[model samples]
Target chain A: MFQIIKNEWRFLVRSRLLIAISIAFVSILLLSIFLGNYQTQKQEQTYQKATEHLRQQWVSIDAMNPHSAAHYGTYVFKPANLLSNLDEGVNSVTGNVLRVEGHVQNEIVHSEASQMQAVSRFGKLKSALLLQYIVPLLLIFLAFNTISSEKQSGRLKLLVLQGAKPLEIILSKTLSVWLYGVLLLIFVVVVYGILNFQNLTAEILTRTGLFFLSYALYYFIISGLTVFLSARWQNATLALTSMLGIWILWTIFLPNILMSSAEKWYPLPSRNEFQSAMTEDRSKGLDGHNPSDERGIALEEKVLKEYGVDSLSQLPINFDGMRMQADEEYGNSVWDKHYGSNRNILHQQKKSFQLGGIINPFIALQNTSMGFMASDNLHHQDFLLQVENYRRVFIKMLNDKQTFGGSKTGNWGWKIDNAFFKSVPDFEHRPTQISVVLSNYIMDVSLLILWSIVVIALIFFGTKKIKIV
Target chain B: MIQTIELTKKYGDFTALDKLNLSIKEGEIFGLLGANGAGKSTAINMLLGFLNPDSGKVQINDIDATKNAKDARKIIGYIPENVNLYPYLSGVENLDYFCRLAGLKYSKTELQDFLASCGLQSEANDQKVSAYSKGMRQKVGIAIAYAKKAKVYLLDEPASGLDPLASKELSILLKKLASEGATILMASHDIFRVREVCNRIGILKSGILVKELYAKDVSANELETLYLKFMQN
Candidate 1:
């Protein structure tokens, strides 16, 4: 087996076509890394400038009412992961800038895809695209004729007569092609690492390493299946065509059909419907501006009783602040109920997409690749959750200041200095741990492992009935 | 030794090999003479453990060929009509690869000696097989068989496309190998060459062995007459 593999490697390296294709593949990977880094740097610079500017504006503001300052919110920029260079995932399509203000939750805006023309939907020329689409095609081309060619030319009979088992022959040929793909993947990864050595973190390294594992498994599946087809088919052309057709089905057609089906299966509410529902729910709750509403009256009465005051001005703290805080609390619950349901639907859709991996392992590869890179929907949701939590904390601080800063119920002129505004913490997003992120993609990873095992088993068992003559 | 007991093969309704029995002892060269689709290759394939017999058994060196193909094939060497090898590899490399597959390891010098012994030019040893003539490729095949030290050699039309000189050279090589105690089973249409090299010859027609005779007991004209009679029937 080793001798066969060695000879195959020698043959592949000597072949001018393979050498040319390999060089082109490496060049594409380098170009993807450069483009990714350039985009990331540009985004980082823009966000850094925006954040600094916001901070300066906050510090230079004149003394203003704490409630007014709460209305004037800030922005949180999503940080770019270095692994995104290899697999951008859904980041290009998703928004990056999130606005954190009082009273209302804002969606992240300014997605890169939204700014591009319709043609960008075909996707960028990223490393992930090549790895998922082109590399597998190349692997199929290399492996589809490994056995059939030998059989066609009558060398297979000689091989069998020379004490080489059909199983060993097929396995060795598959491994040779798999090793070729592995080498290409390793080269691209090494180059990517060298280019971003400065930005290498533990998380980045782990993600990239796992990325290699996923792609290696995928390549093995491709090679094993192609070689098995080669052994099963009588001629090289049939084997090549069958493998090519499978590649097209797996990568090109199936993913789109499955995604659309998943969306139809677990449809999400449109933006208008979602906003209208939230608005209706908010209206039914205590109106923050209309303190004379029944809910506000009940809150005021409870606060007065708790303070042992029967009159409007007898309370130690401002009644208006208490009412506003009550209203804000109700609004938070409404936001949670609506957004939580949306998140659930998204999760359902994701699981639906993941189920496709059982039939098409390409889906598993794409899911795992995007997931580990923190560019998928799961990571985006994590960032949004953190921003929402920050919004709550930020609003609570201002409400507390307004109620306890020696202000009366009707004192609309009450204000806090810059020192107090500075005391409130800025929005800092802590990226979810790799372990937690991996939990969300366990199904995808398991499917990939399962697919690899199945393909290998099929090659060994499926060729048992093959007719070498 | 190579032996088959009532070997038969079928493809749905078509009988490829009939219940034919034969045996060849060590150090003997047997030739199977037949026209196209007479099941000559089929018989060789069955002995080499390539195609399973529909009803019968094959034993190679006293090992069950069907049930223990790998072990049976260990002592066998085969050269197809075209001797198609990895065209990108040099003659020596191709020989070395096949030799390794047969569980034999040879150094470059030994490989070169085997090729030279088979009448291949030393200069062509390092050239890719893609550039080799048919005769040169057949010489490499002989080198591979020699290097493997196989006990049984199977040759399918081994002299078909070769020029007269190359065919004569192949005959000499087979005779020498037989003299060295190697058992050879050659399937060919060359009656004169078979009469010259084979110790015994079998004429096959429609998957059946129609005639069996010793080379020493018959002349070239007699062998042709017998083969033509079997093929025409």
Candidate 2:
């Protein structure tokens, strides 16, 4: 086995194709790292500018009603992760900015894909794209000719006669290709580290490093399978064609089918239906202006009777304040029912996406990479939840101002001071850590490990029984 | 010493090797003489433990070839009909790899000396197999056998593409190996070369070895006539 590796290395050093390929591949990896860093820097600068402009708008608000400010609302967009330039993931398809307001929770809008002339389903020409698809195929091209060419030349028989075990030969060939993959992955990761020097926290570094290891295992499985097929098949062309066919099926056609099917199985209702449902539920629940809403009128009569007052003016606390509190509770229930269900629908969509493991490991890898980056559907849901929490706080504060600022039920002249407005907290978005993100993608990690075991088994015992004659 | 008893191989309904019996003495150059599809290569392949015969058994120096193929294979060096090697590797590198694979670790000088002994020139030793002629490649194949240091040598059409001089050199090498106590079994259609080098010849017809003749007892034309009779019958 060692001799085989030695021979392979000697041959590799002399082969211009292998050397040129490694050089070209490594250069491309470095170029991508530079491009990714530059692109992220560009995006962060634009985001910083946008955030400053929004803050300026926040400071210049007119002394209108507190509820009116709630209606106008503010927006907080999630910033892109530092490593996003490496993967670029579903970021292009999902929205970045979320709009928060009172009495209504709005869906995020202004996705990068929507603004484009045409959406790219395959995503941008990024490093992860090459690492996932092109690099492994290059490994296959390197390994598929390893054994069949030897057999065809009668060197295989010569080696066998010299007491070399078949399994040893297979291992040596597999190791050669595996080493190539390892070097390629390390090259990309070293570039990643050099570019993102600041964000090298332990969790981030570990996830990013595991991401490297998973991809390396993926490359090994693929190259080992290719070499095994080459040993089983008689002709070199046939082996190459078979390995390429498997590559296309796994990387291209299979993922599309699995994704589309998962989408069909876990259907998320259109935005229109969701909005209408919330509106219908909100109208029947409670309205601050209406004295005839059966539940609200009942509650009001009880409050008046208990306080022993003939009119709202006889009450100790402001009637407007009591009404605002009643309205907020009702609106909260309505959101809980409708928006909560929508969130569940998104979760269901994610669960179905996890079922793609049986057919394609690249899908598993895509999930793992995005999950660790905190750029997948789960993180998006968390962002929406945080926006909802902010909206609740913003609305509750406005209700407090209306109830306690001495405003009457129908008075339009009362106002809160700038002090109260300035006291409202701004929304702060915190992305989930890599460990928390990876926890949600355990199934994907398991699937990748499973594939590695199966391919390794095939390389070890599967070719021992091969009829070389 | 190599022996076979009623060795046979069947591929579903078509029988490739018939029930056959033969014994090859130690230190003798035994040639398997037949045309294409005559089972000469198949018989040699079975002795190398490449194929599982449907019935009967083969022994290499009293070690059952089927029951313990690894043991039998350890003592045999097979030179396949078409000599295919890694064209990217130089002659010396190829020899060194094959030698190492056989569990031998020789220094570069020793490897070069072995290559030279197989009639490869010092200039050619450094050249890749891609640049070598057909005869030179065959010499590398012979070098692989010589490097193995096995007790038996099996050659299937070993002289197919060689020029007359190269063929003569190979014949001389076979004689030297045989005289040095290496049992040699070769498959070839070259009846004249068989008569010139091999101590005995066996003709396989329709998956059966129908004729066996001593090389000195039979003249070239006489052997041809006898081969015709076996085929006609």
Candidate 3:
């Protein structure tokens, strides 16, 4: 089998067309990696400038009430993952910078205008795009005629007469084409590694390894199925056309149909509808600004009674801060209910989309590839969650400072020091561990494995019925 | 040795091969003569285990060709009319590749010797097969079977498109293989070539073996006349 595989490689290497396409393929990979790095750096520079300007504004502010300072809330900028050069996934359109303010949980849309320069969005040349779309097509072209051409030319019978089993012949050709694809993947990855050698981390390596594995599995399936069809078909044109048509269906048509179907099936609320619902819920709660409102008056009375004070003048701490913190907590609950439901809808969509992988492994490949690169929607949600958690901590700190920092009830004039303002911890995007990602993506990987197995079995069975003449 | 007992094949309602029995032993060449649709190819295909006979037995040496086609094929070499090979590979490379598939390993020099001994010029050994003539490709095909040391050789119109010299060379090569204790089965329409290369010849007509003749006992003119008579009837 190895001999047959090696011989096929020799045959492939000798093909002028294969050599030409291979050189072009490598060049395109190199260019893609370079462009991705360039885009990442460009985006990073813009983020740094925005971040610095925001920080300088915050630190330069004179002593002011912490509540007002909380209103001048900072931004959490999503840094580009080191492996994003391979596959930026949804990061380009998903909006990287999130606005974290005291009153507003997040104005996610505002960040797009305020921070992102839309660098990756203007027709991005992502390596993932090429690897996901073009490499498999290349494999299809390589393998679609592997057997049928022999059958067409009457060489298949000769090869068999020379002691090559039909199954072995088909498998060997498939492996050779698959290896060619793998070699292209490795070239891209190794070039990426060399370019980013200093930035390489264990997580990045793990992600790269997984990315390679996913593409490799996809290539195996493509090659095996194409070659099996090649042998199954007696006419070379029929085999080539059938494979090309299937490739179109798998990579192009099926993904769109599945995505649209998933969306239509588990529809998410419109942006305005979501905001209105959240707003109505927010209004139902006590208004921290209007302490005399029914819910607020009830709260004030309860607090006054607990302090054993009849009026605000006798209170030792700031009641306004307490009221605001109460409001913030209520808003937190509202945000959770709305955002969590939206997240659930998206999850349903993602699940349905992933399920399509059983029928078309391309979806599985796309999901797994983006997942390992840490640029998928799941990780994007994690980033948002971390940003929100930090915002909660940040606002609570300012509110507590006012409540217990020796400020009076009506002390609008009360101020906090810069040192206290600067005391809030920096927001860092915590990466989901590889283990967690793998566990969450069990279905995608399993489907890919299943596809590989099913294709091999089909080829094994297909060889028996394939026309020898 | 190759033996087919009551070998028969049909395509839909068209019986491709009728019940036929034949035996060709080692060191002998049997020629199957027929018109285009005379079931000659069908007989060859059935013997090669390419097509299953409706009712028959095919045995290559000791192995039942019907039950264990892979093992039987291990000792059989087939050179089709065209002998299509990898166009991108050289004559020698194509030979080497098929040989390797058969679990035979040959050094570059040994491989060149195989091609050379089959009358493929050494100068053309390294040139891509796409540049080779039909005659050259046929020589390489013969070299492939020769190098594998196939015990049973099935030649389907092996000399059909060859130039006169190439045709004579192929006959000589097959005779050499037969002399070296190989069984050769040549299916062809060329009565003269069959008379020259085969020790015995059989005529097939419309899925039936109508006549069998010993080449030693019949002249080429006589065989032609006999074949024409069989076709007419």
Candidate 4:
């Protein structure tokens, strides 16, 4: 069996067509890796510049009202890790810069897709695109004729006469072709390792290892199924056509249709509807700015009673700041209700998309690639949640300064020094740890494994009906 | 030795091979002459364990080819009408690859000798098979089978489109294998070549063996007349 597989490799290596194709393919893959790395590095440089520049401005602020400082918000730039060079995933569509201030929770803005000219439907020439799309297609083309060509050219009969069982021959040929895809994937991974020799981490290595494994599994499925089909059918043309049809269906048509279906099944509210509903809920709470309103008057009375003062002038602390802090807490609840529901909808949509992987493993590959690279919508949402949490902390600090900084009631002229602003912690985007976040990708991994099992089973069981004649 | 007992095959409503039986012993070359769809290839396919007989059994060297085709194929060698090989591989490489498939290993020099001994030129041994003529490919194909030291050779249409010189070489090679105590079953359209090389000949018409005779008893012209008469009926 091993010798038969070696012979298959010998046959493939001798073909000038294979050599030519390999040269072209490797050159393109290297170019894609270089470009993806360059783009990610440029993004890193931009983020560092923006972050440092924003912090510098914050440190230089003079004395100002705490609420005034809240209005002058700072922006937090999302961090791009090394693996983003492989699969940008939702990174291109989800903007990286998020504003953290007071009152409203701002959406991250300035996505690469929005900023770039809309020309290529296939985005940047990333390594993920080539490894995910082109490599498997090449494997299919090579494997689709692995057995049918022999059967059609009358070599299968000769080989069978030479003492090779049909299943053994089919499996050896399939492995020979599958190894081609694994080799390509390994080349990319080794290149990635070399490029990040100084910066390799446990998370990066684990993700890269799993990335390679996922693609290897996918490649085997492709080769196994294609070779099985080649043997099952009588001619190379029919086998090639059928495999091509499957490729198109799995990678192209089904993904879009399923994503659309998932969205329709677990739909998210429109932007306007979401904002208006949040606003309607917020209106039911006390308006912090309106001191003369009924809720504010009631709050003012309660605070005076607690402080044992007869009126506003008798109060020792700033009642306005106290009311503002209370209002901010109420606003946080409104943000949670709306954002939490949206997150749930997105999760449902993602789950549905993942379930679709049982039918098409390509979906699993896409999701796994994005997930491991921390570039999927889930990761993006995690970034937003972290930023929102930071915002709560940031605004509370400002509100507390006003409420307890020896400022009396209605003393709007009270201010804090730049020292307070400098002491306030800067927003740093801490991504969720891999150990905590890995559960989200379990379905993708299982689907990929299931796909591998099914294809291998088909190859073994289907060989019985190969029709060597 | 090669033997088939009441070998029969059917394709839906058509009887492809109907209760056929043949016994060819060692050191004998038997030729099967037939029309285009006369079940000659079908019989060759069955003997090679390529297709199952709907109702029959094939034995190669006394091993049942039907119940255990892989084991039976250990002693069988086959060359099809076109002798398909890896077009990108050299003659020697193709021989070595197929030999390895049959679990036969040889040094480079031994592989070259096998090709050289089978009448493939030394220069052509290293040249890719894509550039080889039909005769050269047949030489390598025979070398693959010969290197295995097979006990039986099942050939289908072995001389359909070869030049006269190549056809003569093929006949000589078949005779050489028979001389070495290998049973050769060849199916062909070339009547003169069949009479020149075979010890016995059988004519098949519409999946039935219509006539059988010794090559020594019939002249080439008489055999052709007999085959034509069978085709007309």
- Model 3 chain A: lowest-lDDT 10 consecutive positions: A110-119
Best by DockQ: 1
Winner on TM-score (2 vs 3): 3
Candidates ranked by DockQ, best first? 1, 3, 4, 2
TM-score of chain A of 3: 0.96
lDDT of 1 at A357: 96
Alpha-carbon runs more than 4 Å astray in model 1: A310-312, B56-61, B64-67, B216-219
Q: Which pairs of residues clash in candidate 3, taking residues 3 or more apart in a chain or in different chains?
A: none
Clashing pairs in 4: none
> In candidate 2, what are the lDDT values of residues A305-422, reduced to their tens digit?
9989887777665566566568777888888887778778777776777767656777888887777766677777787788888888887888778766677665656766666776
lDDT of 1: 0.87
- Per residue, candidate 1 scores C-alpha lDDT tens digits across B1-233 of 88989999998999989988888889899999888898999998888888888999988887998788878887888888899989899999999999888888889999999999999999999999999989889989878888888889999999998999999999999998899999899999899999999999998888998888899999999898888877776
Stronger candidate by DockQ (2 vs 3): 3
Better of 1 and 4 by DockQ: 1
lDDT of 3 by residue, A1-469 (tens): 8977887888777778889988988889899999999888887888788887887777777788989988888888887677889998887777776788887877555333334455534436789989988898888888888887788788878877777778888888989999999999999999999989998888889889988998999999999988888888777678789988988999889999999999999999998999999999999997988967788888899999999999977889899999999999989999999999999999999999999999999999999999999888999898888889999999999899989989999888999888886676767668788877688678998999999999999988868877786
The DockQ assigned to candidate 4 is 0.75
**CA displacement after TM-score superposition, residue A274 of candidate 1 (Å):** 0.6
